[model samples]
Target: MILEEKKKKDEKNEKLQTDLCECYLLLNMWISSELLSICVPCLLKAASKKEESEDTRKEVEMALLALCNLRFIKIEQELYLNEIKEIIQHHQEYHNLTRLAYQSAWRFLVSRLWDDNSLEKVIVVEQHFAREAARELEELSKSVDWKKNKKGGERKEKEEMITTLRWMQTLSFFFGNCYLWNEEYVELFSSIVGVLRASRDNYREISEKCIYPFEEASGRRVVKIGSLWQSGAVDVALEEIHKSAKDDEIAAKILKFFMNVSRRLKEKKKDEIEEMKRKELKRKIFEKMEEEGYEDVVTSFHKTFDFLSNKYFFDDALSLDIFDYLVNV
Candidate 1:
């Protein structure tokens, strides 16, 4: 009876999660379509729902508020510029949703002005909100135990970090495409780099046991890491029950240490030599994998490397698998 009850409870939780995810997806789609009035009501309902946690509710509220700002822009452009001025003159709601809302409003206003028009008003608005958002993100990033929380929390920290990185990369790509780099965007990029550095540290900690590094006969460094726990040294030793396992375990430990060093070195570099060395390291890794007959592993590694390389340099939409890869691997 207890087991049956537990199973039922698990099913109920799954159902609730699925429902919430569907609602969020619809909300995002509606926002993209400029149907903010429709999206806001649904999001507000979700935000007020008693079944969800505070975090989930807050997330929904933020989405609704963002949509409200977009709606204001759309309506102002289409119908009510004069009315919007009067509303802003009288109502705090027109002013205080979030920094993102304020920025969006400023952008909408600036985009309306002719080149001959002075940008003093719009520039003031933009500077105020951009600074506010930057301060908030910076404080939040600093205060959070990002590494530990990312490793142990119910929410997958690695995936969230990767998603955030990809979003920043996309923003940078768009800015470059439009020849519109600005100080505010540069600060955003710096914040992303900080987040990525934190995530890299977390990945190292969580996957410490699985990595191995060694110098091959060619004097090049080779890293042999397990993709999953069972495929590593522990399982091999289990199979070879008669052999002395101490030597193999020691070798694995040494290799793991070297692997960690290689990763850290690559992460810390800013010069051409370091870039060349990173490529050389990747080449050596594939060569070693091929020698070990791990062709599938080599293929997967190439695919991941290529995917990230494209994501870094191109203005393309990222795959959902990028999130899974970053968080899990």
Candidate 2:
């Protein structure tokens, strides 16, 4: 009797796996379809409503998350150059979807964006996504068991962790992409620092192996920027500052650092001396940002920046205020 019951349970588990696989296939097809925005809510409902094993439930959730990410990326690609205000207006209606999508899409977009140097879109995409991934990982760490488990337990946990790490590596790729474009990808640079600081030993090791090239590329750019600034290239400095400011806190700190360094350079009359001081300062600032994980604050700034830059400032500002309060606490 016991043997028969075990056999029946095994069959049920196999069926659950089959169902989850079907859902994932459907999701992948839906992502590339015009019906993605429409199909997503239905999938989310199904994922929530379905009676399945833990593995099956997680698979469904992952599918839903991936679809959500694809939809947001589509929207981002369409509105990449539009005013922040316009993006926010459309984003408000889709905020729930955006949050869900960020879990999967942010990492994927960062990975893809980093690899393609031909695309001249904003570099902040990588920073935003990486920061979000780090945040999610941090939350996951707070809940999950990191130690080895018995039998099927360890495999299941490892699968989930691997999925999460894949997303992190994706974010790292975009960080590299930012450096590829102008080397002034300070937001990307800062985000990479943040992720490295927040990540566990295994995640850190993997990210370094996969994503360190972009960091190297950005380092080269920083050198060029320093040289230009020494040659009285205030305009170049300002441009770099603007691009970096896309990260809000990083921007503010970089601007302040630049102002101080430029002042010292003028007084010292030695470009090499000024460069040394500035490099040290840059290192310290990046370390501080990484240790504090201030990249997470950029999301709130994005909403506000979008609001202030738009015509519907009042409405958007109020909505963002509510969002900030909820997210920060």
Candidate 3:
């Protein structure tokens, strides 16, 4: 009886695997039909991890590889994009993308979506992916050995660090494409700030490799303006200031982030919730700056860059009530 049951189970497993392979083969052949729309969601779900088994991971790898080669028209993609978003956002595990296939699948999907010009359609998708990326960033930050310099790090450690940096670059690209206005986006940028705060030894690398690209891609307008404040980015900035006072470039970049936040806030039509959030953010910033003696850091940054080109930059930032409160107090 035991042998008969085992045989039945093995047959069932074999049939399921064969079915999955055939589905992948059909998808690879570019069969753009209603049938594919059904298959695509199934593939996404199959790729999503639910257990720790090696067999499960192998299934995920195979599904993602098939997804990497997915070819759908704009209309077909539009129809099932929400399904894709749901599967990717809620079903997939953030820490399980250790395989090259997982990375390639995401890269492929994002790049394909990059061609999409329907801002109305893609913004929500981008926001969901951004949150996922933020989760990934948080995981990477925790995994890193922040105390070690790059020269002293092991090869594996360095590879992980590089992966984290590349992830930041990816976020920069996403921010460029999507409007960064949601409160959830605050979580995303906050994660970026968190990573920057933790990786103290890689300050220059983060700035040059990550921050500069992010700044260029996002500009000042895409950000929701002061959303960072609601996400407690002020605290992260203060923490960095306390630890790395001598790194004026990074200090300047931090100030620029706040400045951009304040500057953009001034441009927005004030809703009551936003106004309330702004006041709260301003109060917290002032309290933390005072408690941490960050006034000196700002003073030092101002003195160093008290250049003619930055006169208007400081003026614009201070024009906001938040920066004005900081200055007067």
lDDT of 3 by residue, 1-329 (tens): 22232247434454364356446544465654654554556566666555767787777766765665553333356544664455455446454545343453454365454557564245445535666677777877787677765575543436466667667655655665654355567777777777776665654565334453334333546564456555555666666655444334555555555555444444434688877766665566667668877666666555345442254244333322223324222
User: Looking at model 3, which ten-residue stretch has the lowest summed lDDT?
Assistant: 320-329
TM-score for predicted model 3 compared with the true structure: 0.54
Which residue pairs come into collision in candidate 2? none
Better of 1 and 2 by lDDT: 2
Model 2 stretches astray by more than 4 angstroms: 1-101, 111-127, 147-154, 158-160, 180-273, 278-329
**Per-residue CA lDDT of candidate 2, range 137-231, in tens?**
55545444543334554343344455545554554444435543433433334443434334433343333332332322323332343433333
- lDDT-sorted candidate list, best first: 3, 2, 1
Cα-lDDT of candidate 2: 0.39
* TM-score against truth, every candidate: 0.32, 0.36, 0.54
TM-score of 2: 0.36
In the predicted model 1, the residue pairs found to clash are 213-255
Highest TM-score: give the candidate number: 3
Better of 1 and 3 by TM-score: 3
What is each predicted model's overall lDDT from 0 to 1?
Answer: 0.35, 0.39, 0.55
Which digits, one per residue and each the tens of the lDDT, describe model 1 over residues 215-325?
A: 110112221222111123322222222221223433333222333333433443478886776556555543543455443322344334444434333222323332221
